[model samples]
Target: MKIVRSKEFLGARAWDAQLIAAMQDATVRLHWTDQPYPWHVNDGQEVFAVLDGEVAMHYREHGRELVAHLGAGDIFYAAEGDAHSAHPLGQARILVIERAGSV
Candidate 1:
């Protein structure tokens, strides 16, 4: 068993991630980012969880842009074909689960 600490990700660069597990074509990771990510569509479904701090998630749905605020413990899910981006309110640590090799 491995003991992973999510807080360890705080203050790291945007998009920095720790691989927690991988099964088949799916992966679970812990990420740290204070910067905003570019909008992109997932090759597969995505599950995003806020572990520390706050985040403002931007997503495109039906050609409309939407924003969702995520605090610690909040969760966001994206189906395949969902285009989205995440902008941290400040520095934040998050957990992301998605298909391996997805950009």
Candidate 2:
């Protein structure tokens, strides 16, 4: 067994991650970033949970762009084909669960 620290976690670079689990087709990953990610559509569903700091989540729905300010403990669910992006406020750690190779 292993313990994973989610809060107050920091990494050297953006998108840095710790792989927690890998299944046949799905994986659970934790990441740290201080930059904004390019908007993209996920191949399948995605679960994003904030563990440290904050993230400005940007998403487009029906051609309309929206932004949500997410803090620690907030979760973002991205459905298949849902286009979205995340811009970290300073430094932040995120827990992600999605299809393997989806990054």
Candidate 3:
């Protein structure tokens, strides 16, 4: 398996929002590691899979951090209007899927 570190904070703050593309279509894949970001709910649906390590996903509507400790083969999905953030709890690799033109 390929391992990717979270480079989201490389040239910005820990809270800076960054999105790394994986697969873009009706389903879009984005990867992130070593950082936390804030996001707002848009028009498309999204799915998150932890390719490696652990991450804490916070959703605005939930009002709590969904500390998703994902490893290989783990997955999570968030629907439309689900405002959230992707945060690396450790050295993490996450796969995010969303619709095109939604971000």
Show the colliding residue pairs in model 1: none
Q: What TM-score does each of the candidates earn?
A: 0.93, 0.93, 0.62
lDDT of 3 by residue, 3-100 (tens): 44553333333332245554546644445456766667757787777766677676655575455555666786778877777667766656666786
The list of candidate 1 runs beyond 4 A from truth reads 10-12
**Candidate 3, which segments miss by more than 4 Å at Cα?**
1-27, 62-68
| lDDT over C-alpha atoms for residue 7 of model 3 | 37
Candidate 2 ranges beyond 4 A from true positions: none
RMSD of 2: 1.2
Per-residue lDDT tens digits for candidate 1, residues 48-90, read 9999999999998888999999999999999999999999998
Pairs of residues at least 3 apart in sequence or in different chains that clash in candidate 3: 6-33
**Number of the candidate with higher lDDT, 2 or 3:** 2
Model 1 superposed RMSD (Cα): 1.2
* Colliding residue pairs in candidate 2: none
Better of 1 and 2 by lDDT: 2
